[model samples]
Target: MLLKKSPSNPIQAASMGINKTEDQAISGWERLRFLYEQPSMERDLSRRIINMAFLTGFFFGGVATSAQARETFERSNIGQRFLSASDVLKRQADYAIVRFAKSGFPMGFKCALVSGSIVYADFLKIFHCG
Candidate 1:
């Protein structure tokens, strides 16, 4: 008569290569490798990146639109309030005379100040020497 043998554990069976489909608990290193080799994982990462970029672009576009709308509204509202050509000329003449008077001193002072300001301004001007 032959004696009966005891059944081996899953780990011992798999290690002996006699048993297959071992769904038993995997070690830390094996689980990590399995996850690293998994397919469709990169798709999840890429989807998140694309979504973030789209949101950033959308936010900036909204800001730009608001800025443009505000500028348009200001232009429309202020156009009617701007001074007319005749009014502008009268105001400029009035302002120049006031500025000249405020410069103080005499006619000689006026000539010297005017000539100095003009000379420096002309030097700063762009010239097409051609």
Candidate 2:
């Protein structure tokens, strides 16, 4: 029996009664080629502008957050001597223990520990301390 080759099928072409050159040209590789058309110059420029704006906003947002954290730290006056998160984490342990001891069980100790941990986390986020 003769197999009729469809232009879209190569296996049919290989076993076909008549092999057309155009059918042979539609290889598996053609499907792998990029299907999307290139962006127009205006579209490309707008994309670039949008990307830059997003990056700029991201940078400024980080800066603003850090500044706000620094202001909060200054206002709190908890550990004025400690400059960064690493310093706070290292030295605050002693303070935490002392406060825990003075304040004692359940409520006081928990409050001291939780507050200290939260402050350390905030400092780490803003300062990216080692």
Off-target runs (Cα >4 Å) in candidate 2 are: 1-38, 74-85, 89-130
lDDT tens readout by residue for model 2, 28-93: 322112111233343344445545554555444444455455455456765466678898766555
Question: After TM-score superposition, what is the CA distance of residue 43 in candidate 2 from its true location, in Å?
Answer: 1.6
Candidate 1 global TM-score: 0.28
Find the 10 residues in a row with the least total lDDT in model 1: 119-128
> Can you list the residue pairs that collide in candidate 1?
none
Clashing pairs in 2: none
Worst 10 residues of 2 by lDDT: 119-128
Local error of candidate 2 at 125, Å?
A: 41
Residue 95 in candidate 1, Cα distance off native in Å: 39
TM-scores for every predicted model: 0.28, 0.29
Over the full model, what C-alpha lDDT does candidate 1 score relative to the true structure? 0.41
Stretches of candidate 1 exceeding 4 Å from the true structure: 1-39, 76-130
lDDT of each: 0.41, 0.42
lDDT of 2 at 107: 41
